[model samples]
Target chain A: MNSAHSDIDRVPMQLVQGCLVASVQVELSPEVLHVFQQDLLEAVRRTRARATVLDLSGVSILDSRDFRSIERTLEMASLLGAQPLLVGIRPGIAASLSELGAQCAGFAAFSTLERALEHLDSAG
Target chain B: MIELGTMQIRDEEAPVQIRVKVLGLLVSLGADEVLATRVATAASELSHRYQLLGAESRCRCVLHNEYSSLLVEFRFTSAHPHPETTDLEGIAGVMRMGRNGTGTDELVVQIKLPMPRDGLSKRAIARGRERILQRSRRELMDELRAKNAELEAYNETLEETVAERTRELTHANEQMARDLSAGSEYVQGLIPDPIEEPVRVDWRYIPSSSLGGDTIGYHWIDDDHLALYLIDVTGHGLDSALLAVTVMNVLRAGSLAGVDMVDPDRVLFALNNSFQAHHHGMKFFTIWYGVYQPSTRELVWSGGGHHPSILISPGTEAPAMLEATGPLIGAVEDMDFPAERCTVAPGSRMAIFSDGVFEIIRDNDLVWTWEGLVEFVDTLRGAKVPLADALLQEAERIKGDASFDDDVSIIEAVFP
Candidate 1:
């Protein structure tokens, strides 16, 4: 009985002084991809914030399919006129993004949610 | 190349007769003037007498490519017959080739008039060749269009056949679904509902599919004696359901036949015998039969290829498992499933369940151990809620809120 539970990423999303801060969890499986799509879309529609920080520190095995599904979520956010900032990508995931070629073309990335927030604050 | 019949003009006799024979042969063989001019002038001079009409007509003749023929431009045309015309009678007329591109097409004609030679015109020859070529092209186009239409009709028929097959397949699938629903209902009917007395017995059976081979039954063999049995078929669905029905039928029939045959061992033996006699070398079943005599406070039970039954003390916090000591039913000749009798104290409760209850997993672990089950029984030993409620809760937990991989059955009985 090997009882090793998957250590999934968890995002602690909150509104700090009217800035929306989102923490992301593990890359969801294909079976639950639709759930994240709907949730992200709904959040973007409800909050007309100027910037959103997407946290992804806990994601372990993000692949091309995950990238596409996440891209759809980001597209939905953009449709609501919100600026999405990527944050907390692991070093391994970043290398994989380059290897997959064209799947991540022209996508923005960042290291931490705090840094993404600072960058947005400076631009604002 | 076209071969013409030989002409019969005699040698060195009539030069005019030889000339007409040479001209006719060239025309029949479709030779150009350049080729016809190759014929010997001696032959042409001898054949020259045929072109002379009643009046002299000036004719210029030239032999060009071969020694066998000549080209003659004659300036004579008349309705009057010629002196050498009888010699041309032995030669047959021209044989025109069919327009199948299978014959030589070397013919060319140009007639000139120094006299009244207006009968054979150049425009008439050109029109005749144009008509033949036009008819051949039109026939080819019509054949191609007919073949294309035939192909389209075949494709339409193929599409229609595919649609018809799809409809038939969908109909069969719908019928199969209906049969399964009916089978589930029929199997559910075999198990009795909660007993409507002070003694509460709750049983749950969750089939892996709409129809599975698990059966649980409750019956009163006689006054103060209640029999509870649970049987699981070795396989799933229809085969198991059929076997369960057969076992139920045989037991009912044996009981109805005589009182002596109503014993649990006797009923099971009869079922095993029937299986051996009729369904020999085939299927088998696991059954736990227990007869509870309220008057004697005795639970007379027998096990055959079934999981152990859990017995919980009425007013205590402990439970025990009664393991089977007999072979599975329908295994060999004269196989007898031995019976075990235990004294039941008043207010003592017991639960009989299948392996399905113990096989469930939760959070990647078996839901409960036998020790855990004993502790669980102790928790609900004297609760205000009925034993049926507690058992249903336990079953639901074992099923992980209705998620199970196999059939589940649990029968709880509290002795009076």
Candidate 2:
């Protein structure tokens, strides 16, 4: 199993400076992706965070399917009262997405998690 | 130098005939297949370009037997000024623009191939040329008769093979599991191969012993129309597969009388009247039938209680779902399966699949929904993995194993 999920039912979400931050670290199986979606939405609803920063620095195999899943998740999270902030996108992943003509033009992305948090903080 | 007579490019078939002549010449001279094909392609392109220069244009092909190599030259002449080296896409060897600064509309192209150890004698060259000449009427009739006889023998053999396989399955019914093991190749032979030209089509089919009777096929309805469909009959095992194949044959042959099967909705209506569940072995089928018109770039589709097919747009816009909501075929007679039409832009893609493509049981013991499939495929635009393989892989991932409980069929067509 190429599942990055350490636990089946749990998805780790942390809060820092009144914002929720979750860093994706490995290739996620379909089950893990579903679980992550559920857990992220629940955390957003519970903490009522203004911004949620998702870091993708550790995920190297970012294929189109995963990229699209992340894109949908971001839109869903935004609808759930949390401004979704994507950060830590590797250069290779970005280049691949553009090369394959993936729809990356709709969202604004950041180079680092701290930069994302700083933007959120300054916006506030 | 053997001056092979020049032929006029009267129509589209002229270039093809010219290609055949050059190919035959090089192949007879011991040129390798690759080199022969390249030189033939270059000759055909050069001649085709000459034809395009207006009605007063023509090309002559000459074969020059040299000491070390066989040199082929295409001498092109036209009343219209030859523009910029007769654009052959730089396909072959040495291309000389024109004649001795005469500024005449003549573009000469030369291609060389290494000569065989023993060069052909004059008599042998003439013999080869004779062999490559167009066949006489009597010769064509003789070839046609031979081909027809061969086809009849092949059909008889195929029938015997199918009959023998069926008998073995029926006799080993008590040992059904063992007999079913040999059915993988038998089922594979019924599926169509991937098509590349006119319209690019590819599909993935995975059959488990417990999940049979899913068939996907496409055929030209006319010179400009193509019919694409996926049919899934009820139940499992060899009986259901036979039924599916029967229905596919019916569709492929367009044998449903009194109705034009080329129209998608009409085909469904006719099928409903023909294969009712209660009357026909308690089996009903769900099918998504669509027709593609290359001339109009239109796709008209209708379904009998099957899942909606997805049409991915050309650009980054979200995909349009072609909803199909009629009742299952054979479940109800005279069911009006309404058809809808949409224009397919260049670079668009269509994915018509059975329910098994998206309706997988997840690890959480929940069946996947069409919405999940929509979102998944939406991201699959510009995906690294091929569409059919990617869908199957994702289904296996969701199910936690490679074994599928139902037939997994995905047919993808890309319009360029």
Candidate 3:
């Protein structure tokens, strides 16, 4: 029998200067996305991270369902008292999302990781 | 206990007398108002039909209270023997037709009424039965008149509600049409006029909806280079059109700080950095940007998630499709778009278009592919018909319709 935990690809996250920096490098299936949300929220609780930055530079295709997941993640972070920021969205992905009326309402978006970090640092 | 009553119908007034007796029995049985009215109505109809046969008609009604239920059985007989049971409308009871043992035809109707939850005393039942029997015909007629007025008022209210909802829906539809028309006009105004310079340029645009997202424009960056671009934003309608117009305005203004407008790769890179998908309502677009150097007769181009521009040079039998240099723009960060160079000789022509031009459904229910577009263009290479008009005609022929499912935009540049 295959083990229940055989193929779980956890999203890579790090703690930097009292903040949680989670980088999503792989295409997130629905199941994996749900697991990621649970794990990220648990990590935030454990580290008591002051801020959260989701680096989505690698995501090329984003549909309405994916945007909904991202919205839920941002909402979760805010509920946990962590300021969430998004960085590194490609132009083509932006066009597709904008066409669907997906607005970055709760989170701030930056073109580069460095810029996003700089903004977070200065704001803090 | 069971009680039986018999009536012989000899004239028109006999049916009414029987109907009053049925109502009295129902009230004594403690049946609800609606059930009592329905049972009485059924009894009247059966007796009336028997009287119309013009024969000796007799109706036998038996009322019994058993196992907390009121059971009323109506047995109707006529001398004609062929008693038609046609007046059973709106009766919520069981009925049976059978011949009696006395060589006579009979129609039997059985109505069962469950005892009310609040059981009535024997005295109350007797009093109710007495009250119904005491009411005159005038009072009964007045009660029927009141019920008709109530039903008419209810029907009027229902009709008025339907009319108000239809008016609201029509108004909303008209408002939407006006908004769409205004949006289409604004998008049309954003398209640049044809430029007659070292390079001749003309284009065509058609939106499946009132607003389109396909935008094409070309302008001279300097004396050395002419910058040309075609962009197709995802989806259609007002949001897509607005994003396409925003990108066009930025490119026209040359407002990206420290970016070289004449360089194809730099232009795409700057656009990607500015319109990151997450920042601009999570929207992304495909762009093909190229710069033509008249001095060198070289066309240097770069594309981000966009189909390559088609180049047709002198003495070449087929058009060359310049492949994409990098990934689609606005999705990833710090992406590099490499430029590809091709020299254009005199009398050569080049075309840049959105994917909608080739991905159309033809009359045969097949998609018009890039190869099909190339073959169509080949036929109109040297013809007197303009390139934009020729492509539009081909699209119409393939679609067999005037409208498309997506926004179609095509730009044609002819080198003199």
Candidate 4:
């Protein structure tokens, strides 16, 4: 689904088992990221998912602003009664995130979708 | 003998008519071409100014033979008298202020020329008089032709000089470009080869067209401690690259006297003290320095206004970003870089890169953010592609046909 701005497409949000999985594949502008955050939180509330896995394997680069947005999204997801897990950070992206000082210390992280699912499953 | 001519100034054409009458009288008096033109121009200016007073103005010219001198006098009268004759300072040969018999304010400007000598015989005098009248017309035509030739020569010289200066400038610019290209090559050669050891180090470096300031290197401080760093100077070009190379050399040699190379904080502190921003043409740099001890699987790191190193452990989904612990190097005096430690598991990967690695503009004019880089790298997790190749390919894909705006440098170390 398209957001209010026709230029930005919606992030794919799926209800997998008891978790909400949002695969963010496209390059996110600040405006698009804002829309995605709101949509993800709304989806979590509607599905009543206990956990959410944010797949960032498609994101190859991030700036400081985008990093801050992801941090806020994680915080908001937790506030909405869902444990947010960031998964599949590529090596280059991981290096860049560290370089930008986006420690992402507020949420849990998994290297792969399977690992993230297993961790969430065990925790649940 | 005296010849008198009078002209009334009623309109703008009055000055032109007065100049023609004065020039004819001067030429008849056998005056030189230069002197005749000067007197004609001065008479024209005076008549024009006198007409501006808006009164009945009349110009009277009298050519008379006075002893051995031929005197030409131009007298102008205006009903509205203006005694301000200072405007005639550099114009007329002599300006006599007097009143006519009717008591009108009159200005008389006289131009005197030397007459033919009295020693000349009657026959020579007659011939001289005839020659003066005949050659005067031809002389005026010759003077006009000479002036036009002078102007044409001056224009040609000006064009030639402009062309010569343009050629010199083009040559200088081309030489400078060649020197810069050679200098950039030398700087690229300064980067050390990759290390294939307990910690396999692989790096990718692409200098921007303007030669940006990015230098990365890793060296073994001892059998146990391995020091790795990435330094980004404030700008591009020779100066920034030179500063980067200087910092790299010092790091490579572990040459900071009395500072422990294994300690990231101490090393950065010494570097800050050594390369003060004020001393280096006000240039400053950001640096990420880390000392890894394979024995303990621990990395002690510190940064000066630099992005943190990403530590991706084995079996971990999210990589940890190690951020800067201090301000930029050479920017401030007495700055401290506190060291932080993180455990690096076997089969884990750590990447230290400059901001240029991810600060790319996409074809759509949007920046390829760090999030995009992360997602792209995640897809290569199990793939056999090297980290540097993967990053370069992804960057190219994101950038499309556009070249990088800054130098991109990356150092990826895999612990087997």
Top-lDDT candidate index: 4
Task: Assess each model's interface with DockQ, reporting 2 decimals per model.
Answer: 0.00, 0.01, 0.00, 0.00
Of candidate 4 chain B, the 10-residue stretch with the lowest lDDT total is B129-138
TM-score of chain A of each: 0.78, 0.86, 0.92, 0.93
Candidate 1 regions with alpha-carbon error over 4 angstroms? A1-124, B2-160, B256-262, B277-281, B315-317, B361-405
The runs of at least 3 residues in candidate 4 whose Cα sits more than 4 Å from the true structure, single-residue gaps closed, are A1-124, B3-155, B361-366
Select the stronger candidate by TM-score from 1 and 3: 3
* lDDT of residue B279 for candidate 3: 88
**Fnat of each candidate:** 0.00, 0.00, 0.00, 0.00
Span of ten consecutive residues with least summed lDDT in model 2 chain B: B83-92
CA shift of B62, model 3, Å: 24
Please give the distance, in angstroms, between residue A39's alpha carbon in candidate 3 and its true position after superposition.
Answer: 90
Model 4 interface Cα RMSD in Å = 37.2
lDDT string, candidate 1, B50-75, tens digits: 33333332222222222343223222
Clashing pairs in 2: none
